[model samples]
Target: METIRYGPEPSQLAELTRPSGRPKGVVVVIHGGFWRSRYDLSLGRPLAASLAAEGWAAWNVEYRRVGNGGGWPGTFDDIAAAIDALADVDDLDTGSVLTLGHSAGGHLAVWAAGRARLAGPPWGRPRVAVTGAVSQAGVLDLAAAHDANLGTGAVQDFMGGSRDDRYRLADPAAMIPLDVPVRCIHGTEDDVVPLSQSTGYVERAVRAGADAELTEVAGDHFVLIDPASAAWARTLQILTALG
Candidate 1:
């Protein structure tokens, strides 16, 4: 694994793992912890290594969480910068970049995929485009998640309080029909993040003529990220098929 700095902040960096030879593509592994500082990038290391073993380059990213220097635009800024930073890395085929994120990270993954649809700073003109995405029990609908308070006010905290028009830019559910493909994987018994999050988003996306689908597996929220779990196996299969 190699450490690359996209910005001066300690958290504004990524850990990159490469396959033994040329990689088939790059997968950005985003971790989940309700977008809090306590949950760091270490959560993504296992997935990164696993992707490398499968002959794909994995970019495990870290960004400022709420307790740190992240929230609203700051967190969004870090994600965009981290992905754009890949342009500087050699021997990488950024053209086919994809994202695999769990929980809060899942929201960010889908959100990032629709960056180009947004119109301005913190949201538009992505330097690196997301070709595809996989959301593992993500909090996809910001408005819905806010109302349900799924993360115990996590959505409010991440968005820095109440919803407004600008938030439409942040909600993946609102930004349907993304140019890239999106696959949502949710655990049937996930209570941490309700299965409806993925199901609802996919339903809305399909209605909007977007390339989206959902797959339900047996287990809880964390099972999807466990490298050894059958859920993860299904995830790998989807990733391969998507590519």
Candidate 2:
């Protein structure tokens, strides 16, 4: 594994590599855990390493989360910086870079992809575009997530505020007009984020005319992160299609 800091605050981004004659691709993974400190990108090591073992370079990213300097524009900013920094790493196929995020990180993945593919005020425009994006059981609708309020005050804390925060920074349902290809995978038994989150996102994305695909399998939220779980295989298929 390798590490890099995208922010001045020592926030880290990590990667796991498998020896391949030529890299198949690079998948940048952002962890979920509702953007809290307790849920570091390190927890997703199994997923990252699994991706590597399955033949892709896995870049696991950790940025400022709640209780640190993260939240709102700062989180988005750091994500962009990390993606940009990832451009310099040696083993990756630059044109084949993909962002795969779980839970809250899924929300981050969509936000980051939108910014990288579209030009607008909220974001300063991406330095470069990525190949694709994957969101696994993400909080796509900020207002909805805040309303449901999963994991105690975890959502609010990670967002650092009211529903408006979700609207501005974390609402991929509203932001899915993005040009980049996006594929979402969610477990049906996801007691945490419900399948509606992914379904609603896909519906809205279709309405927006963006290229999107969503799949539902049998399991819970964390299954996506488990190397031994079925959700990981679905994730692998999605990541490969983008390549």
- The per-residue C-alpha lDDT of model 2 at residue 139 equals 78
> What's each prediction's TM-score?
0.98, 0.91
The collision pairs in model 1 are none
Each model's lDDT comes to 0.92, 0.78
Poorly placed runs, candidate 1 (over 4 Å): none
Quote the positional error of residue 23 for candidate 1 in Å. Answer: 0.8
Which 10-residue window of candidate 1 scores lowest in summed lDDT?
Answer: 120-129
- How much is the lDDT of residue 225 in candidate 1? 90
After superposition, which runs of candidate 2 have C-alpha atoms over 4 Å from their true positions?
16-18, 117-122
Residues 157-194, model 2: lDDT tens digits: 76677776347545776676878888989999899888
Cα RMSD, model 1: 0.9
lDDT of 1 by residue, 33-134 (tens): 999999999999989988999988999999999999897978888988999999999878898899999999999999889999988776698888899999
